[model samples]
Target: MINKMEAKHLDFYYKDTQALFNINLPVEKNAVTALIGPSGCGKSTFLRTLNRMNDVIEKTKVVGEVLMDNKNIYDPDVDPVELRKKVGMVFQQPNPFPISIFDNIAYGPRIHGIKNKQKLQELVESSLKSAALWDEVKDRLHDSALGLSGGQQQRLVIARVLAVEPEMILMDEPASALDPISTSKLEELVRELKNNYTIVIVTHNMQQAARISDYTSFFLNGKLIEYDQTNIIFTAPREKQTEDYITGRFG
Candidate 1:
């Protein structure tokens, strides 16, 4: 299988506390790989490591490698800013900038120096369409993004990411805050996004993982307990710990 990114013997530390241990995982191109685990199981920590998001934390150190296109992203020469552009992130909360919806999608491209109004307009339209929110917000592009619903806000955040033309999207419980209908819509957007961008998501919702991910990695206490196809992991996990967690016996 072709991999877009891989973590090789990756370990992370926050000061003296090691939050991740020897995480070896592969992210396939244009596919969804779900990181599933209970709270505090290092899923989010591992997600942040992919694009060096952990670097922002004071006294945090990453050892070993997180390779994107076979180059170690943690290398001293790699620009974190550029890396972030290629590996966009979405948090659990919908954090619109309180600006116009059009401006929110235009923010990243603007920072990267796209000055033509026509180009920015096209990008904003396409990005919104990519996130499947264009029809709802087409006439309201000039409206404040905060005026949108939670689901719309989250999709706006995603459109903002897409405007930068990222190769991979990392989502940390991207639907956790929404109601069932909103969550379903977000999930459908995710399934569609994988057709264009590699997706790595960390979710506490096991059923969500089962529904949307092509592959799954089960993490526990800072270690990967199992990694396999979603169907296999869900139906026939090789590890007993993985089975227990999926079966809801213990976290």
Candidate 2:
């Protein structure tokens, strides 16, 4: 499998404090890769670097190479806005737009200059269907998105991301805020979506990581401790820190 994204000697700092250290990993194309570690271990920081999301934070400095599809994302010529369009993100919380569900999914295409009603409708329908939310919300496309349940809202967010037709999807604890059933549904959606889009998820739930990820990276104290196949990382990690964390002995 070809690598969809790669990090080389990644280091991040916020003012005087360093958050990541010499991190290196490869994200496979059309696969689910999970970043698992204790809180504040820089997993989310690393995920944000993929699409330069950290650029918005004040006093944040990044020194490393984040390569997506053979192009260095941090290069001076790289357009952050275009990068973001190619690499979409889904936050931990389900933050649906305060508008009609159809409009929420149509927003991205509209921004990209697609204004035809039929085309927008097709994009909305396909995106929602891809995110496994079409049947539930098809009749209510014009309903307020805020009225949906948490899980539905989350799926709506996923559909919105999909409508943009991103090549890669970054999920920062996509299901962490949801209940078990919702989480399960999200996991199923991730599994289904991986056949088309490369997925990188930052999650603290080891069980969820083990359940859904094809690859897993373990981080500790702003450093990458181990990265390998998910099953091997869970069953018999080469690093003691990884073993301890996965076995629940320690973070």
Best candidate, TM-score-wise?
1
The TM-score of candidate 1 is 0.99
- Model 2 worst lDDT window (10 residues): 242-251
Q: Which runs of model 1 end up more than 4 angstroms from their true locations?
A: none
Please report, as a residue range, the 10-residue window in candidate 1 with the lowest summed lDDT: 49-58
lDDT of 1 by residue, 129-185 (tens): 999999999998999999999999999999999999999999999999999999999
Q: lDDT value for candidate 2?
A: 0.95
Please provide, for model 2 over 153-183, each residue's C-alpha lDDT reduced to its tens digit, 9 standing for 90 to 100: 9999999999999999999999988999999
Q: Estimate each model's TM-score.
A: 0.99, 0.99
Give the count of colliding residue pairs in each prediction: 0, 0
Give the TM-score comparing model 2 with the true structure, all chains together: 0.99
Best by lDDT: 1
* CA-only RMSD, every prediction: 0.6, 0.8
